[model samples]
Target: MNYSKLLFLFLICVLQSCTSQTKINGVSFVAAGIPVTDKHVNPVVQVNANYATVMPFGFIKDLKHPEIIHNTDRQWFGESREGVKQYANSLEAKGIRIMIKPQIWVWRGEFTGYIKMETEDDWKKLEATYSSFILEYADLAQEINADIFCIGTELEQFVANRPEYWNALILEIKKIYKGKLTYAANWDEFKRTPFWSQLDYIGVDAYFPVSDSKTPTVEECLLGWEVHKPIIKEVSDKHKKPILFTEYGYRSVDYAGKEPWKSERSMNIVNLEAQNNTTKALFETFWKEDWFAGGFIWKWFIEHDTVGGENDSQFTPQNKPVEMIIKSHFEEQK
Candidate 1:
């Protein structure tokens, strides 16, 4: 090849390589957001990059379930903490800043078999439960040197009535925990939430249905994102704050035409398919949106029997196709 042609090709390759890579603290990050290469410059160095939240690092443990809590306390606590530590270690080792999300919520049954806070007493109990949970989780985050911490997840009814309580909670948390703080409000209620001013960033659990049908095509689902974009922009504009999707996912099962919302029915074929399709649609649409900082799937894992149910199945993220899709997506984003 001619000398000019060879040099032109070399320049093109260098540009492409640079475009596809980001380096922090000497560690190389690929497009997918995950660090593919790292050198031990110092873990704390990477913790400074201004990136969206770094997670799927967070999960909910049913404190009401003795067995679940026991297992988590005995094995998962250290293991999960260490796993996050390694993640932070890798990213920070490269000088990348990560936001850690540790969410506390009352499980489906723990709050009178519903996701809402129905009464004043219910709100009080939930507030207390969350307060204690945050204390424990905050300590864990500190141990792992997490960069940010979410104090609560979607408990809208409670938040609406107890705005002062949340302000108080944030104050108390600040006294103990030293990192960015936020609460994950449901997408519909995020605007009505009175506590956004107290948080470092507005965190939301945005799983608005992109399509009404059980099995919408990927293109149809992506189109639905158009509907949500304005809502996201409005929130960001009004609040004048960056947003994060703290919990977001769809079931892979089809609940289109089944009794008792078939997708919630255990061992029911209709529900299983609906769940799967919903899962597929969610991933397709999420990647298309640019307003979001980033979000964690509804969950990481759940107990075996805890899979089927109305709100339950939608929140469980373990062993699903969505998980693999996320891993691939983030890898590419890196």
Candidate 2:
């Protein structure tokens, strides 16, 4: 080829590489009692969301208990294996991609991160039980052609105490699931996770406290990200993996940015403006970045009409002013 022709091809290659990355404008699609149909899933498409996470949950009695409960009679429709398959099919039909995310919930809102055993034998038992829960879903993920399979979520101390178990678990999961892999590390714990290199994306439940002000302005929230953005980027750089916010959002309440991770019921005033500005700050700061792989908003219910309103002080941007902001940004990303 002539020099000018070769140069033209080189520029085309660079541009394609730069524009090929898809911003994963996603929602943590909440499980509901009834089977999800096209009606339940259309809003995700309406918002221009190309991705949605299907999170099946495992539960233990408490932080110390090794025995885990999953796919049992007490669970909701979307938490069972068949439910996941149904939900995933509906999403796929709509042309939305899937991320089968299996997370563990400790009883009584106990943090999964604090789970540790009193003895090695018990730890072994816990690992065995947890592996069954995850691996079963891994098979389903592969069967459903999920785009990604999350190995775990926010299990900090478990990972810290048993990194070897986690490494083995990842290999086992990769053996069964034929797709990308990620772990939803808590914001404070992602830096210490030892297995980012084994996964396709560096996943963080990035509820970083960005601002402390009551109903802080967008500029204030943006300033808060300045402190954290570089730190998060450094980890992605070290791992040579794009950063994916497995879960990231702000509650529609006063001081929403102060403790973005906390979800306990609060009597604080509902500040729609705070949630709107804080959420917009997130999209503005991270959505355009080349290294940031994009994010799933913390929560989105299947039913759109009655979920969130001005009076509700919840994490969901559903039906609120912030919803439009999310829609606009997602539209642009597509």
Candidate 3:
């Protein structure tokens, strides 16, 4: 080929790469051991989620102990490396950029953000073990050409207390991996995180409550976002890093907007409209913001084709009115 033709082709490739990284329309695929079919993949693409977050779990029994870094033996706790590779490949095949987000699931259902260590020795051990766990996936992320790698997720206590450990971890991950990096900080903890300057993006698991209504209107949800958005923008400006809602969404139940982050609430009514409207409000509020880099809706399942419907109460916005809201918003972005 002539030099000019080669230059044009090179420019095309550069443009494609730029768009892939900057476009943050995304969704979180459930960490299922088995691969999901085209039926599962098609919807995300249809919704214009150019990115997908794959969360495979790592287990730490106690804050005083090191993480148990076993990918194969314990099937119930997390997706295997093989499973992650398969799912990542599947997403890439459908033109989706992948973010390999490995999260810690503590035994006895304790929140990872609440983990506490009493001694320096325990902290050191936790850092070393967690580094090994993160580096293993760092290698996998490099091999798969994944777009981003979240070094840690919602380990609020550790991150707040041990800035040196996280800084070292980010440096180590950069040595071996060539993708963007971010940490998924819980809604209340992002401002307190001290390591944002070392990473590519500020990631928030944005489950901030927008309202307390059993049946919230889109305007009400927008009001909730209005109250919270200034803080998000201020953080982005302080660090000069774009923000990604690494995880966001609500359960399809009554009063979802009241506590978007809650795992369970006393009210049990299956209010699909509440879920759908809250989602619509959030998109309308955030999608146009220049500093907002988009988000991954909390989750989707591989075991089943759909998670949200008339009768369901979980966070997946699939197979319901919320799904259409997602689809329309994403399509508009494209």
Task: Give the alpha carbon lDDT tens digit for every residue of 1-334 in model 3.
Answer: 9999999999999988776544488889887645666876887788778889887778877656665565865674237778788888888999999999998878876788888788888878888888888898999999999989998899888888898777878888999999899999999999988989989899999989898998899998998888899999999999999999999998899899987877764656789989988988988888787788888987876544545667788888878788888888888777
Cα-based RMSD of candidate 3: 4.6
In each prediction, how many residue pairs overlap at the backbone (N, C-alpha, C within less than 3 A)? 34, 0, 1
Where does model 1 exceed 4 Å of error? 1-129, 255-263, 270-290, 302-324
For candidate 2, the 10 contiguous residues with the lowest summed lDDT are 260-269
lDDT of 2 by residue, 79-158 (tens): 88888899999999999999999888888989899999999999999999999999999999999999999999999999
* Alpha-carbon deviation at 107 in model 1, angstroms: 7.0
lDDT of each: 0.52, 0.92, 0.84
TM-score to native of every candidate shown = 0.59, 0.96, 0.90
Candidate 2 segments exceeding 4 Å error: 1-14, 17-19
2 or 3: which has the higher TM-score? 2
Inter-residue clash pairs, candidate 3: 211-258
**TM-score of model 3 vs. true structure:** 0.90
Error of 3 at 220 (Å): 1.2
Q: How big is the positional error of residue 56 in model 3, measured in Å on the Cα after superposition?
A: 1.4
Give the lDDT of residue 254 in candidate 1: 54
**Cα RMSD to the true fold for all candidates:** 9.8, 1.9, 4.6
